[model samples]
Target: MKLSLAEQMREMDKKAIEHGIPDIVLMENASIKSFYQILDAYGDVSGSLAVCFVGAGNNGGDALAIARHLYNNYCDVFIYMLVPEEKLNPSPKTNFEIIKNMGIPYKFVENDDDFDIEVINEADLIIDGIFGTGLSRKVEGRFKKAIELINDSDAFVVSVDIPSGIKADSGEVMGIAVEADLTPTFALAKPGHFLYPGRIYAKDVRVVDISTPVSVIEEFDPSFVAIDSSQIKLTYRNPTSHKGDFGHLAVVGGSTGKSGAVIMASKAALKSGVGLVSAVIPASINTAFESHLLEAMSYPVDDNGGFFSENSIDSILEFVADKSAVCLGMGLGVTESTKKVVKAVMGIEKPMIIDADGLNCLSFFVDELKNRKAPTIITPHPKEFSRLCGVKTKEVLEKRLELIKEFATNYNCIVVLKMADTLIASPDGKIYINTTGNVGLATGGSGDVLSGMIGAFLAEGYEPLQAAINGVYLHGLAADIATESSISYESLMPSDVIENINKAILSFFEA
Candidate 1:
């Protein structure tokens, strides 16, 4: 399903209403789904206490409707309205009056002084409806205290739509947010439910269908997506095709102490189905790579102070002649000679995966990217991205989507911003979020493995963007598989991920 921002979802809801689905009907459906989800979570509600913190908007109306359902089912329900009954929105006020007529007790608490903490503590389940996706301002006053009370309580919190205080568009916390055990979002999942601090707050999220027609969602056409296995495509190879037909790949970079980076990347490229893999390293340590990389061909490049020298560019260019794609800058340190070498490599028109020290090198020559003719793919973790953009780390993290989009559009390059939730931004304005991966991928050399895998895909004739998306997904899937085998995310190493590449590929096809 296409993951959306607040604006896109609001537009979809508006379109649904315009197409004959009434606002009241959607509310009723939302209440019904939330009721069942609560029942499914806590079994019978015969005499349990359900305290619903209602707001002044449609979200509050949802809680009021849900409260009525709980009251009808013989559960003791209390309504804590944050606004006056007469000040509520039309639909919510209507539901409020109905609940009052039905004899369900409610208290209007506009500030902390009016709220009773003891009453909140007695609840078996708390439904947070204080705010939804439309919340923009920082939460304060009575609403803030109410969220604090709900969180402090031992009750199982079920947030309606989204956890209060999370920005729906960016997944950023607005001051503070309620940590929910279950969030039954209406119609579709928002970016907040999956992005970092917000994702941490929203423990378990389940998308609830509220009768919005599938046609409306399709018509909206949200460009952002969380990739699933169904979208992965590995074309059938010709039965008569030979090793030479699959394409050759080259991995460059690896200084004095960091020769293992290129070795790992080369091994990963070979494991990713590249027909022939070549490892290019410093001449002094060429024997080291040769001994370890039994299947991969090794070439010696000139070096100064254990790093690639500017003079080696000619040899590197010569070596890349027969290669279809190249993965560069794994551990090549940021020295003067290495900078010149990187400049020469970037001048090549071959599809290249620039990563690690390569990204550091590119930061110095970002302006050169506008003049490049080839499709350049740079894989940078948050810090590396920060350096490349010449911004603070916090700025990069806070405005990731915007910065990535602008960089890709301006540079005309495919960018892989590696984070907990990896984002793939294309030059043409498409964005993809990887749905597979675990904490096990947090180890060293994991990014190096990913660079090699993407380079291998580029060699195998995949488009630059698709190559990045597939490589990232498969890399994470391999880590997830490794975690499954060991039943631990901590024990899985980069090599373990490489070992499971075949299994990950098979699983993708099976899926």
Candidate 2:
């Protein structure tokens, strides 16, 4: 299960308390992990000063324990314990006394300027142990000034639990967070570790276990799953399965010069396990697609070259009615006629995939998607999503999960928003963060090939959700496999990726 910061914390606390592990011991666990991590980052310290910024809660307590460790390790570690000793949190109270009793010089600041200049100037390494997950407000007043000092310092800054002032639940920044060079997060990685402004502040990420029970997390059912290479394996077909036994997928798109789009997509579908594939292009380009592609057959429709005309929809629906599964909208340029053709095909109520030009068509008449009367998967990048929602691209990027969930539910479709980390959101609110592919799948026709491959799985009579998850996985796995062989994302073309699909699928089956 994919545990968020809050969920993991709740789970950890319940188990710890149930097992008679006091909150103090848990704090010690956190402190030990933090200290060890710091030592790992910068080890063999001969003589260096570590200035820790301590707050009022457990994070500050963690700082105090770390200070004790540094003292024992022969480093000149000091604490700028900002929260007053009189106002110290219970656990922090115990640790602060321990640090003070150990004879480490600790500074308590009541003024902003005095704290900033002092902490910044005297710091060799700044440890950010201020305001962990308990923070609900912004870092302002005295703390804000201190955070600024930590940010400006040339010292190596290590964040204890998380970067202070970044929401653990959501990745939203609360006022200000300490910009840490390395952040050692407890338990599962927090959303802030990979999401936006918070990610920007956290230069490096490391996950640590504070002795939380694995059984406790079993009870926590997280909706999001980060699909990694370490996850499921997708492998090639067995020797027993031949051309007819696999599956057949029909892709309807491409207008003349844009034939490469349909060609690329069809090739990927075939390579990913479809027994046979056919691209339904304009009647004029049938010979070209058929000639270039031996494994895939080409079925022709109306129009000379540019777009799928309104009159072409009837012939297309009739031609693909008996096909296993259908893929549409790769390089089929947007036109009034093409829109009419798409709407009619969509009306046929067949299991299908809609991407590229297909998504563009939906932006105009979003109502058509209202009643697909059948299952459909829609893959859209940021710009396409912006058009569909009639909002700015930046707005969509900012609230990616919200928009994807809303859009998926509204259209009764599965939404795959392609990004550095692709998000697959189902209509039921289940979201998957694909961790398989590297930046190598960022090329242009990459999306088209993905939709086609997914369509191949759909055509084979697999469950829609399963097909989607598998398709995204295989598409990315192909890129990952290709990348391992020296074909980086920057140099990868759609055609090049087709050869890698079988390898990726086989890898999954073996795993």
Candidate 3:
């Protein structure tokens, strides 16, 4: 689904109004849809006590209308207006008048002292509408107190649009944010609803269509999308096809102590439905690969003290010459000789996925990425990305979307910024946010598995973007499936994720 930024949503609303949908109509639709969501969650809110915290924006207007609907349904409703009635926006001002005429009990409060703690604690539900997508500053004063009270209470909370105080575009929490049990966003979900701290705050976000014209939304042409099963297009395997019909994948990386990384990567590649898989490693660890990898082949090259050296470059290049795609850098020690080999492999005209220590080597000379004519993909966590971009890890986390896009556009490659919420950026500036996988994937070898999966897809003739998206989504989905089964998050391993790849792929067909 398309994920909109705050500005894009505002422009969509403007275009909707221009297309003959009145602003009031949209408000009513939002309120009514949001009310139904409440009804769905709590079947009989007829006699429930609801305390609504209202601000001076359209989100407050939505709260007022919902409070009126609750009152009409025989519920006891109380409105705590943070701002004076006169300060409300035009549409919200109209809603405030209607509630006042209907005798909905309300009080103007300046701070936390005026709030009735007993009533709030006793309330069955709290509707949060103190702020909306336009919030650019930290929340304070009455609004902060209200959010604190709502969070402190046991009452079920519902937020309008997005959880107040969460930045709509970046998901950054402004000082404090409302922790809602549910958030009914209108038309489309904002990036904040799915990104980091905001996703945690805006829990169980449900998108409500408030009659924004389809044409208006399409005209906006949002660039960000959430990766899900609906976006996965799995190719049907021909029953008559042989193993060679799929494609061959080459896994190239391994040093003395990190040989397990290449083994895990090769195993994941074979599990990803690749026709054939091979690993090129230092000769000292060849026995380990031969013992662990049964279905895949390994080519051991000359090494200096069990680490890759310049002597292995010609042999490595010759071994991977016939491979369909190459997965580079998993446990490959970052040294001068290995860096030379990495550079030599980059000149080959095959789709390449660089990860782990490969990224570390590339960071030494990132401009080499622009010299490659073949498709290139780099999977880097924040720290690795920081090295490539010459920024701090904190800055990489803060400006990941922008940095990844800029790198992809400039280097002419696909960039996958791996994090809790993995972001995939194409050279064309399109971004796909993956909201799969759990804390279980925070272990070692996970990234290695991801590289192999993507390499397998690329070898199978999937386009660079599609391969990256599918690999990322399915990689997380496999971990999710493992955790959902007998495996606990603490016990979940990269090998377990590889084992569940078939199940994850089957889930797409099942859905």
Candidate 4:
């Protein structure tokens, strides 16, 4: 886990200073890295043109320093300091004087008259240095005008560290943020660079080492984790193992109108390497799985057509006898009888995943969830999570790490808080933000499939956290592979996701 985007920079700078790395040298290293990124992306710019937007703070220093490098490439560069000369700090003033001494064209934007929108528009690239990770307030006045002008320009824009006007810690846009075609960030990718408005604002992101030592990262202890393709590949199953050794998952859910929920989970379970999958649903679905699900065995539970009743508990218990894991929720209707059945199922001692309606049931039975001997996981998409937490959806979306840890500890189960960036939080406060899924996974029945995938990992012997981390990573990775047709999130369906699970899984074992 790395500290957040803002905190990461702060810690890096703090330690650099502590180790006696002068502020100017650190600024020089960062500026050169920024300079290198621009050259790498756009290639040699000898005899080219660039517009550098600088602020009065040290942020402006980075732009001034980079202006020197662009000059080295024989480019006509202009440094437009958005702040008045009187407002500039010592470090920025020192750099500004150096740029003037070097005879590089530069000026301060006193008003709209000094605003060189045309000069920037005519340039090959615009470098954003108006605000860095330290900005915590709303953008207004000339700063806003400068940002708008640079954005409207034809020049391919590149942001330093983070896109201006976006909060590095919370990833919220203060007012209006700069949209960059490429953002060269120092140290580690900021939370904003990866989160909602910032993620969208940061068109393309790259992290430069900047000499932020590994020892410093360990000291600060970051709450966030970046999931990579290489790590998922590391969790591969043994090729020599038999089918029975993989795992067995019992998927329980689906009603008349909701039959598709459990169906997707079963298909996902089988596709993710669970050898034995017995889907116990309303008797109506047995035929559905028989025709639609080739590999999954359907166990018919007597139902009143629309929901599961207490009567199925005996047979459901019997179905769970040899299964290594159980996945409940999905289309299981929120009926009185179904509630009782969910309660009865939770009391059984086996590894279980409570999802969809199952999560709703567990929210009412915290004591049962905590007392259970089995390793249990509860997967809740934002809306479903709102129901369990009894709070507004915004609260969860805004302060995800806090809300997830609170719920996971209270219920004594691993909580997978699903959204655009899904969070897997454990009772011990270990949180991992899933880096895989795209917007294409925002459709119905997606959570059900994810629930089954986690259970599949659990039955195969991964710990609760490992199961959750691996499951979420795998589910999103699968969706990324399935986007071959360039399907947008709105048009992507759960079935489309199921079709790619094998490809996603095999990618882990590929030579």
64, model 1: CA deviation in Å?
1.9
- The best-first sequence of candidates by TM-score reads 3, 1, 4, 2
In model 4, the Cα lDDT at residue 227 comes to 60
Q: TM-scores of the models, in the given order?
A: 0.94, 0.85, 0.98, 0.93
Task: State the local distance difference test value for candidate 4.
Answer: 0.81
Candidate 1 colliding pairs: none
lDDT of 2 by residue, 1-511 (tens): 2646565676667787798878788788888887788788877544888888899877888888877887788888877878788888898899988887888887887887557475467677888988887677777888888888888888889887778888876657899888898888776666666655676777677777777666766666665666655544344557787777766788988886788889888988877777888788887777778778888888887784466777777889888887777898898889888888788878866788989998898788977888788898888999998999899999998888889989889889998898876788888887777656777777778898898888888877677877788888778778888888977668887776788888887775665
The per-model lDDT (C-alpha) reads 0.87, 0.80, 0.91, 0.81
Question: Mind giving the per-residue lDDT tens digits that candidate 1 earns over 441-501?
Answer: 8888999999999999988888888889789999988888888876578787888989999
Clashing residue pairs, backbone N/CA/C < 3 A, model 3 = none
Q: Is candidate 2 or candidate 3 better by lDDT?
A: 3
Local accuracy of candidate 3 as per-residue lDDT tens digits, 9-75: 8889898899899888889899999999999976689889999999998999999999988899999
Better of 3 and 4 by TM-score: 3
Q: What is the C-alpha RMSD of each candidate to the true structure, in Å?
A: 2.1, 3.5, 1.2, 2.2
- On lDDT, the candidate that comes out on top is 3
Clashing pairs in 4: 2-222, 3-222, 5-190, 440-489
